[model samples]
Target: MLSKSHLKALSFIREFIVHEGYAPTLSEIALGIGIRSKGVVHRYVQALAQEGVIELHAGRKRGITLPEPNKERDMTLPLAGRIAAGRPIEAIEDQVRVDLAAFFIGPGRFALQVCGDSMEEAGILDGDMVVVAQQEHAADGDIVVALIDNEEATLKYLRRNPQGDISLIPANSAMVPMVYAAERVRIQGVVVGQLRTYGKR
Candidate 1:
């Protein structure tokens, strides 16, 4: 239900928040959409806020934040604190809402919970939820979720040999690489972001 202008504004806001950790200013929004009037930009922003695409603060200049729409639209995930501070923790009864679309890049992206330490050297720890973008193919050295022999799924660095054979290299050196013929393996997606929560499950 969003117009082209409104969608453009949302796209700009998405990119700005991803890179800057805050919303763009009115003038910045204007420049992004080629609007000559700040008033016009403000109106567009207000419209977006009304649509539940963004949350607006009344008094602050950089007050726009992506709305955490739980059952409405967009993905919501728990942000359970930091990794540095650690302990055996239990899940809290109350949860904070965070819109995962703000952090993810492409459409059709999904998350998977990492199960083992096979990719620990790559900074992917067990219990980490990896955001993966669906794809049929991948470039060299890209970490990908791959289906092996049409049965097993695994996360590893994908390397294709000149002969077209595939090597699934585990980041943890202790784990040996897995080799398979190109015909036997299917690429499901590429790892885009790794999410982890500490002090809570």
Candidate 2:
């Protein structure tokens, strides 16, 4: 657990890095936090560094850097929810850590898990992990898990037919194509990585 002051400092540091693209100097941090003494900021920084929350670069214009955001096994963190296949699941406070590391192949990454056989043809199945790069849009032919009508999420190969109609293709031919307006689909993420369980039966 982190002290309230330390957490506040971390929040301030993250905001500064995001907006200013550099860690503020001790004096600047002190001013930002409305503290009178530079030593107080320095001590807080040192404490945060020791706690593995942030790092300081030696003799640089912007010395402070945020550690890569990683999930910790704790009860206070955000809980995950079920992926909607027919209708989007209502966002609720009940999910646990879904191991989002695989999705974050690089910066600005996120992840979600697969839930059904609607996409089995694509090798995505129930219990398989789906890593996705966070984005607002996807190119045609990309296998994406998308939100339809703001009610459900489903996985399919995205395509634009010759007639300029949008379709979600299931790799399994037995499964029919899902057609919808181009603007009706909301791409949550593109499937970039998958995890499978194996056992010789």
The prediction achieving the highest TM-score against the true structure is 1
True-structure RMSD, every candidate: 10.2, 11.5
Per-residue lDDT of 1-201 in model 1, one digit per residue for the tens? 356788899999999999999889999999988888999888889888866788899899899999774747645644322221011122222354445655463456666666677788889887787777879989999998787776567788899999889988887767678889999988878888887889866
Q: Which regions in candidate 2 have their CA more than 4 angstroms from the true location? A: 1-80, 84-94, 100-105, 199-201
Clashes of 1: 0
Residue-by-residue lDDT tens digits, candidate 2, 97-164: 54433113344444555566767766777667666665768898898777777766777788877776
lDDT of model 1 at residue 113? 66
Question: What's the lDDT for all of these models?
Answer: 0.75, 0.68
What's the TM-score of every candidate structure? Answer: 0.59, 0.53
The global Cα lDDT (0 to 1) of model 2 is 0.68
Residue 9 deviation, candidate 1, in Å? 6.5
Itemize residue pairs with steric clashes in candidate 2.
79-95, 80-95, 80-96, 84-153, 87-151, 87-152, 88-151, 88-152
